[model samples]
Every structure is written in structure tokens, then in C-alpha cells.
Target: MAYKDSSKLLPPPSANDIISVANALNTLKDVKTTWIIGKISLTPGQQKFWFEACENCQKAINVDVGWVMRCPSCKEESRVVARTRVGIAVDDGTGSINTVIFGLDAEKLIPFTTLQFWEAHTR
Candidate 1:
């Protein structure tokens, strides 16, 4: 007798299970905020800034500023400032949370790429 192949016959998630997972993901977003450290290189001529970042779990790591920009004329250094322009968290439909951020005028922020954010937030 031949055995049936059952590997592809897994049951779909139930509504209650889906809701539970959603609640858990929302809780993660509510309780955890990942702090990403990085340097921003400014191009004043082009009116743009490029950021290279390293993300850490805020609850697990120490805060450290990664880089500073110095004025060429005044010989003074200034901390690069970044504001959270937009933040949205939602379920990815795969039983996971997806958080997205955009810069001013909906410009894409490269440092917080989807993969990077997912990796940082998820185990």
C-alpha cells in the first residue's frame, strides 16, 4: 500500500487564530520601538540626504549616536536630525506585522527598508 502525501494539506488559520496573531503583532508595535543608528550624508546641492543605518531593539541595546556633521567654515559639529514623518503598522496578511515609514512629501527612506525593518522587529 502506498502512503498518501500530506505535506501540502495543512489547515488554514482560523478566524480566532488570525485575530490572536494580529493582536500579538499590534502589541509588539505598541510596546516596542526599534531605534536605528546611522549616519546621514547630506547633499545640499541636490537637497537630499543619504542615510546608512544599523537597527537595534530599543529594549535590548544602549543608545549611541553614530555620526555627526561638521561645518566647514565654523569648525563646529552638529548632530544630524531626523524626524518620524510617517509611521504605520499593519498586518502583512501573512500573520506578521509590517511597519512602514516615509520621509517628507512621501519620499522613500532607504535606511528603513522593508527587509531591514522586518528583520529588526522579528526574531
Candidate 2:
């Protein structure tokens, strides 16, 4: 096939990278994050999908009921930010597997910030 714009074209699809749910379940460690085609299932029991992480050390703090937390990991009173943590299930023709999509990835997929998600869920 003759190509006009090669830069806009995707690399030729390879079966080596293209994986199914069956293959993912059996050989996940062997596969690289090259290609995946599946449906993202947002039906999970866990309602909350965010956590307060320390600003300095980026660790999960123990403090609750506030935005700022005294981090035990960093031994400092650092500001805590709600981080995205979405759980999703990917399903191809074969089967499905549960996966946690965290950080910026979750935020990009869900179309909402962690704070926004919490506010929306609460109401």
C-alpha cells in the first residue's frame, strides 16, 4: 500500500504485541505494554478511587478528616493531595482481568480530577 502521510500512520499491527485477555491472564509477565485492545469495565464494588499522598515523600499518610497531613514517612507536616486510583477490568474475546489504573492515567481515562470524583460521588 502506498502511504501519503507516514508520520500520522500507526506502525503496522503486530500479533507479537497484540494480546487477548486469555493471553494476558496466562502470560502477563512475558508481555510488554505495547498493544492492548479491550473494553474498560467500570463496575467494581470499591466506591472510593483516590488516596491522600504526601507531597514530600509521595507516601500514603495515616491522617484522616483533613487536606493536610503530618506524614510519618517523611516526618514532616506536608500537604496531602487526593490522587487518582481507578480500578478497571479489561475484557477481550477470551476473558477478563482486574487491573488498577493509578495516577495520571486514571485521571485521563475518567475525565475527572480526584477531588471532582469525590465531590460527584458524595452527592
Candidate 3:
């Protein structure tokens, strides 16, 4: 038996190419593309913008008392918070899809504190 190197058999696509949402969904999970940003939508009945988490482990905080939320997993109480749930409506002109954006990207698009976003959206 003989071994051959086939790593460079095919050239990868350009890293900056933008692809349609529909196409991206159908392709391999590893395929990357620069999708266009469109609209921001919070799903119905989702009123909270941030979720409380354990300060040490960053796990979800299920118990809340006044200003503190305690983590069940770590058994620690901390006021640390994290973005809850959010969806960004993205389109490449060919089609549109609701993609979940988190962390810094979500903050950039929303541009509001968790409490503010919650209050604004809820009303």
C-alpha cells in the first residue's frame, strides 16, 4: 500500500465572498461567507434581553433574589449577566434568513443596554 498527500487537491473559496442565506444553509457547516446584515428581530414572547449567569463559570443563573442571580451548576451567586436570545434578519438580496447573533456583534447592532433593549422591545 502507498500513501499520497491530497490536502492541496482543491483550492478553497475566497475568504471574503458573500453568499446568500439560502445557499449558506444548504452548504457544509465549515463553509464560511460574509453575509449581509439586514434587520433585527426579537422573537415573540421573548421579553428579556439579558440572562443572568454565574460569575465564575458563566453558566445560566436560574435563581434570582433581588439583584443577584445564583447559578445552579456552580452553586455561586453573582450579578454577572449575558445576552439572552436575539435574531438578526440577514439577506443577500437573493433570500433572507434569521440568524442568531451574540456577544459583541449583537451589541453593535442593538446598541442598547440589556435593560434598555428589554424595556424598548417589550412595549
TM-score list, all predictions? 0.20, 0.64, 0.51
TM-score of 1: 0.20
The lDDT leader among the candidates is: 2
**lDDT of each residue in 1-123, candidate 2, tens digit only:** 112222233355678767787876777677533346799888579778887677666566655524676678768888876666788888887988787766666777887888886576657
* lDDT value, residue 35 of candidate 1: 27
Tens-place lDDT digits, model 1, residues 87-117: 3334334354434333332235444543343
* lDDT score at residue 37, model 2, on the 0-100 scale: 78
RMSD of 3: 10.6
Better of 1 and 2 by lDDT: 2
TM-score of 3: 0.51
Worst 10 residues of 1 by lDDT: 1-10
Tell me the TM-score of model 2.
0.64
Error of 1 at 11 (Å): 35
Query: How many collisions per candidate?
Result: 0, 0, 0
